[model samples]
Target: MSILINIEDLLSGSIVEGTRMEFKKGWNPVPIMRSICAFANDFENEGSGYIIVGVDEVDGKPIRPFEGFNPTNLERVEKELVGYCNLIQPSYFPRLSLEAVDGKHVLVIWCPAGANRPYKVPDDVTAKHKSYNYRIRFRSNSIIPNDEQTTELIQLTAKIPFDDRVNTFASVTDLSKSLMREHLQETNSKLYEESEEMPLEELAEKMNLSQGAKEHLFPKNVGLLMFSRKSQEYFKGAVIELVEFPNGLENPYTEKQFEGTIQKQLIDVLAYIKTNVIKTKVIKYTDREKSDRFFNYPYDAIEEAIANAVFHRNYELQDPIEIRILPEAIEIISYNGADPSLKQTDFDKGRVRARRYRNRRIGEFLKELRLTEGRGTGIPTIVKSLADNGSPVPIFDANEPERLHFIVEIPIHPKFIEQGNNQVSDQVSDQVSDQVISIIKYCSSPKSRQEILNFLGLKNHSMNFKRNVQPLIEGGYIDYTIKENLKDRNQKYVATDFGKSVLIKIE
Candidate 1:
């Protein structure tokens, strides 16, 4: 089976971290088995790791002029690997691929987090007298877990992350071949080439997106979320709902819902926000060569906040990820907050880190799609983005104690806040001067245009109407009673709920 990631990216250490990858000059059965076992343990919940044989290493990185494996021994090595893997207590087998790097063959082992974990293997696979122990990856080395760590590992028995667990309700057909191909193509994976000809089950197996016995295959939760367009059917509230409260929640508001593959929804929602909400302002300075340029709310901060919400949210919840654009801040809310290990104090001090990710497989797909940087970078990225834009410090609330919900409230830039205040002041000033407030008050009960003109002591000319009542209608202070027939002789205007709120403010 082909590895889901680009082989070149793996070799260069561009996408995968050093701790998750190891380079071996040649295969030595015992050490390879230990590394494989450690990777299967996945001590940090950082997802599966890779082992590259036939590459010399120095300081934990691949060395150039690799000592490639002898191609003639490929069959014998495969047989040996299978034999050693059988020594694992639960009979775990990692995916292996053979590729040529710089005119020489190398063995790539993809050891995903095992289903039945806390796997143990004999110290020496060839020994008749064997000692078995559980091994885990620590940074770059495989080590036997201490008693405390061993107990923790044991607790994770048969406890695959929610995203990685096979969905008994979903079949392999639920995963879209097109979506899988698109993702493979986007990541530049070689799997994309073979995807067209491969059956759905085979392709899913190659991507590690399915599990169970060969006869009764089921798609994993991550697979459905990433590939199925109708993800909400399976995972309730697998959508984003964006609400804009331009005039406060008490008044009229606009809303939009984004649904699709999680990555697609993320992209669409971000684009919608950028075009509709994000505003750039320039302040010229006499003392400096460059003008001050910043956004109302930095795009980076918003992007990371929203992406993190999707990555960490509980898919089982009925609450959609929500983005509320209020006058002073944008609140990104999701259900079932941070991991239990993270305290409220951690969120308060911006030291948010996950001991175990709620959705490891989702995070992996997002990282591959370049939608997020996994491994606890989301909070810091947001903080830096806000700081750079001179926006107010973001509020991170993990709904302490129970952590029933998570909220990231990013304040609007101070300049934008000031500008909003000034605009309100200007609007009030304009209304007072134009005598439109009186017109609105007069129209509390729907009144004809003639009655309004007579009340305002204004002429009935088009310019007079445009200057007086038209502004009120356009400002949302009043609406036409006969809105569908604007030119109807019986058309009348009445105060809107928003207009009543405005009167409360100004009165």
Candidate 2:
């Protein structure tokens, strides 16, 4: 078992804090349920996260080591959590554990990435009374859900099996011997050498590629996909198209169509990306001495994104994988839609961290070739790399029903110098401000406090905003108006002329 992380380590930011402990004098199922959902959602959005329950906070800071909850009580709390999970739809339970720290029991709930892509709370009392929701935030204090988040959660709960599970009707002759030989070479030749004398049927069986009983297993489509030289011949949608555009999004400066086996196509595509994408870094200098500095787009992130597109793509969609490269960003779009098991908001929270390959055979083969690190680390790695590089977080948007798009924008670092008229910062900021302004403008009508929180990625900071929005209202930049349907007197905010003016100035 992973050691229970130290309280200080957790408090000092070693772990991503979701909801802090609210030590109410009495146990309340609603708050606990909300905390579990929030924390689990956070883990799903972020990866390998924690929900530290025990410590008390005052004014948003940990005030004292928890004087509440003893060991017996902690055990009772754990049992209650388990009961809560059992009641949830599809179940929102994590692998629950208890840690004793400074004589107080801290509940550490570890929510592993769902094998089913998305996990949802089943229709129980909690699900019925409370809305099915996920949370995210921009600043730090608000927690809110939007239509997009609700839709995403619902979509995630719907089951969509990996593409490889679909049986294809192709024969062993469809298998590419050359590709088989290459796979052998790439994976250290052990499997290839052992299977050399065996018949194709025997080989398929030995490799565990056959699905059902050996007698009924027809090595048609599976063989073609696994070993065929021209895999695209058997599966037309298996190819990847990599296009590098010039300065703008108009015509492509260079475009290459990669066909044949997935492995071969991936190798070729990555090589193409490395050659075409220009990477630059910033170097800092002292008053006298200069230091060597080098920075480039993270190879791991790019590779993972590409690998994910190829492996997780929905070949059944009959759309080709497309990689578009521009001066500012690289977009990888796969014809398949978002993982049915994960919500879009969960991506921002770093909540899930288990790899669920749409093509199990392809995933296994790629793992053997050392093309990808198994265990669902690809997305996290991509997010982390972008964060480290000082680039905006990559966006993963679902085009619905058909396509999953990933856009990675590589900004020119502020330190890099250009020839004439090098005002990249102003240009980029202006673009970002425009985007932010557009969102603000769209919410012009009086929205619920939740609506604004969702719009600004401030779901985690809802309470803070509840306290702060009044000041903005008092300042006359925004005003609160009551909702027509709701009985609550508390009003949501509408951007005032002043707010609009501020936006216009920035734009």
Candidate 3:
């Protein structure tokens, strides 16, 4: 495998320490080996991570670049680190290279993602290694999963959705009767008034909180999420972690983690985003536009995306569904990908619907709560609402794009969204050919691929549109008004901020 990071950037002090990259002042045999193990078994990470021994990390930023390794002893360090990699229980071998950063000698260890995952430190290696055996990288640190976390990870081998399975460790008493009664009232069923008087055991069973009958029973993940006071106790990462990074990616302007009932978490997260992250823009009233009030994104779109994350995310993976708010966009990230037998491109246009659900039981419950349609309307609702609000096309970015992780990124609105936007950077204009620019300019408003062809006084050439217009869409210079409805005959394209930049460049 190739080296995980750019040597030039590291020398220039551009890359720093984080989940995927780490820098050290000097080679410490034990800690360096532990980090290597963590990087190898990076289940939640996108790609493999890199370790640079030479730079000092301060305040979460790499600084004070130094000669990382002793040049005369560099070969010896390599031999020792390689030995450590071999000593890992599952065995992790990294690409060891001796390179120079700013004339300072440094050793770069490129740790590849583990082929045999969930690697552990060998018991015979050392007591330090044994004590901190199976390690996973969280942020920048190699963390030991506590007893509950270990149990949680092991229990996921059944490959069932957490909400669908019975919680073997939790008993019927763990689920609160009051929470069940409140849930019944929220449903507004004819059974609502009667549910208060109903025995707790029957109520629990009715909610599918347990298996079997009166005597033998246990709480399910869904029951804990909805009924338990500390649902996060069992479902560790079920919380919604909201962080607004106004200053930069590394700096958080505000941060909050919401936990409780699944539905409550959803509601509170939506409220928090609307109150804090949602920005209102005032436009000078014009003859063309009457409304003065314009929000950064549609409220409904935000709600749909968050609700979908809660209902659809793999709760077996111990990572909170993270909502990151920034000036440019709002990113709602869920752990793991959806099941698709097809190739990555099959879901690229966002049309592939899984034949079954990863969370069927939880989905059904959300439907009863009126939180979601449970008809796969989650994505459609998010896409339509954003488009209606004059936002850029919503994107579902995934690390394994073909695997289908649900990551809804809703870009904050630029001015004049429906007609497209105000001018953007000319970076894309320089990237495209003259033929593409003309088609974009001709689209004063939204235009179809065929309409543009007619405007250009050319007969239909399917390949020509694909070659010219398709690139524009991919470059983020232009977008379809109805991205989810790409098959629609009336589907039209409009220039984005970046697209407008291309037009201004042409002018």
Candidate 4:
């Protein structure tokens, strides 16, 4: 089966980087085995690399309009590959696909990161006297690792990244065809066109979303995260919790929880924020015709911050990704801090590049969806977005002694903060007139409108309630308990943090 990627994109080095691809004019087993061994090592934990034969390349780029491989030799090549692949110490075999690019047949070798890594092969597979050495990819070329690098490769033994590991609890049937097809379609992969005709198991294999012997295939963790709505069942706390504090964290705040496929959650949360939380403000000056336009918190900055949290958080941990939208700033918290290679200095300068990713496969899926730019640009992107909006530099708090969690605190725009403070003061001083303070204190806990009116010794009238309580709600002192269904018969009123603060100041 063909690998789950756009063959055209792979050749053009658009999606996959040059470091992860090697092009050859012809099939030579000796060097091919070396590249295979190096790719299996996956020294940088950057997911799998591919090798394409029957295509010539200069400076690691494929020369198009390639001379095609002989059609008659296809079977011969496959048969020989089996014997030659076994020469590696761990016996690794790459997935082979004959794809037609520019009407020429090129052999695409899909060398996924091996579960058993640090593989070694004979330097010369054809020589009478063989020398086996550990091989790894250095940029675009495959070469034997030196002593120091070899030691590092050995340390990676049996340390396959979590996302790539097989999920024994899940059967191939657990994989959703619709979600998988949707991803393939979104990525513009050739596999999507043939997905409908393929069996579930066959499709899973073609996509590299399943593992184990063919008789008892199981879905990989990455596959479930990308393709299953029930991913939360397997991965605990695999959801996003968003809390908004118009006043402060010390008072009552509205909350929402998002659960689904990670991609779905990401898209849904972003939409929710844009519709409800994000706000734009215009500042006009009498001396200037052009007004300054800026968002309270730039959407792009928030997008990168939350997307990075989702992509980097340890799924095994029970802590759900938490986004706290405070009046002064937004904080995105995720468990398991940045990689050790990232220093406080790096974070301070907004230049963080991880030595290796915690979830390489997860990064691959997110990048294809255009939700993230996976090559360690998440922090830099957030910094740039905030700077462009005239906001304060974002604060990264991953300096815990044990480095247990990662926190990104993005400050609100200065103008918005000032505006909010002024509005609150004005409401408390100027408009805290008729029964507003009494209503806020009465509704500290959730209370129906009629109950609040009865407490005030007033009759149940919509106009009275609007006059006494609507100002409190509009001033951010009160909130509807059922925010999504504001007009529900059972909806109740409650005092928000801002309202409690007002009562404390006046009373």
What's the lDDT for all of these models? 0.82, 0.54, 0.66, 0.82
Q: Best TM-score goes to which candidate?
A: 1
Candidate 3 residue spans exceeding 4 A from truth: 1-160, 286-289, 341-347, 401-406, 416-507
Model 2: per-residue Cα lDDT over 364-456, one tens digit each: 556555566555566788888767766566777655434454433444333333444432223222221222355457557777776666666
TM-score of 1: 0.81
Report RMSD (Å) for each prediction in the order shown. 14.3, 22.9, 21.4, 12.5
State the displacement of the C-alpha of residue 104, model 4, in Å, after optimal TM-score superposition. 3.3
Q: What's each prediction's TM-score?
A: 0.81, 0.48, 0.49, 0.79
Where is the poorest 10-residue window by lDDT in model 4?
422-431
Candidate 4 segments exceeding 4 Å error: 64-73, 285-289, 419-507
**Candidate 1 lDDT by residue in tens digits, 85-174:** 999988889988887678887888989988889899888888889899999988799899999999999999988888898999988898
Q: How many residue pairs clash in each candidate?
A: 0, 38, 2, 0
Q: Tens digits of per-residue lDDT for model 3 on 123-167? A: 335445354377777667877767875664444333445565778
Span of ten consecutive residues with least summed lDDT in model 1: 422-431
Over 4 Å off in model 1, which ranges? 419-507
